[model samples]
Target: MDVRTAQKLVMENKHAKGFNVTDVPLEVCLLQGEIAEFFTAWRTSEGDAAEELADVALYVLGLAGILNIDLAEQMEQKISKNAARVYERGANGVMYKTTPEQTSAEH
Candidate 1:
C-alpha cells in the first residue's frame, strides 16, 4: 500500500483502540519505544522482528498523519540528500558527513 493508505489505516486502527495521536510528545515517545522493540527483536533473533519493524513504521506514519506531514515526500527528499552526501564510516561503525576538502584530504 501507499504511504497515505498506510497512514489512513494506522489512524483508523488507533481510533479503533481509543487512542489519539494528538499529543506529539507522547507519540514521539511511543515511536521511540517501538524502535527499541524492533532492536530488541533483532538482537534476540525473534521471528517477529518484521512485525516489530512494522509497528515502528505504523507509529511513525500515524504520527505523521496526525501532524498532517507528508512523510513520504520528506523521506524522498532525505534520500536524495543522502545520495549526494560525502560521508565516512568510522571505526565505531558510525557514518559521519564530511566536507569535500576533508574527503579529498582523506584520499
Candidate 2:
C-alpha cells in the first residue's frame, strides 16, 4: 500500500484500538522509541530487526496522519533538497554539509 493509504489505516487502527490518536508529543515519543528499538535490533543482529523497522514506519505513518501532513510530499521535497546539498571535506577527512548561502558567506 502507498504511504497515504498506510497512514489512513494507521490512524484508523489507532482509533479503533482506542489508542492515543491526537497526542502529537506522545506520538513523537513513541516513534522515537520505535526507532531505538529498530536500531538495537539491527545492532544486535536480531531476526526481528525488520519487524522493529516496520514498527518505526507504522508510527511514522500514524504520526503524520495525526499531524495532517502529506508525508509523501514532504519526503519528496526533502529528498530533492538533499540531492541539491553540497558537502565539503573537513580537515579530518570527514565530509560536512554546507548550504550555498553558507559557502557564499564564508568566501
TM-score of each: 0.76, 0.83
Segments in model 2 whose C-alpha atoms lie over 4 Å from true places: 101-107
TM-score of 2: 0.83
Local error of candidate 2 at 35, Å? 1.6
Q: Quantify all predictions' global Cα lDDT against the true fold.
A: 0.87, 0.89
Residues 1-107, model 2: lDDT tens digits: 88778888899999999998889999999999999999999999975899999999999899888889989889897888789899999999999988763355664
| Cα RMSDs, all models | 5.9, 4.1
Lowest summed lDDT window (length 10), candidate 2: 98-107
Model 1 weakest lDDT span, ten residues long: 98-107
Look at candidate 1 and tell me the lDDT of residue 37: 94
Top-scoring candidate (lDDT): 2
Q: Can you give the lDDT of residue 87 in candidate 1? A: 91
Candidate 2 lDDT (Cα, whole model)? 0.89
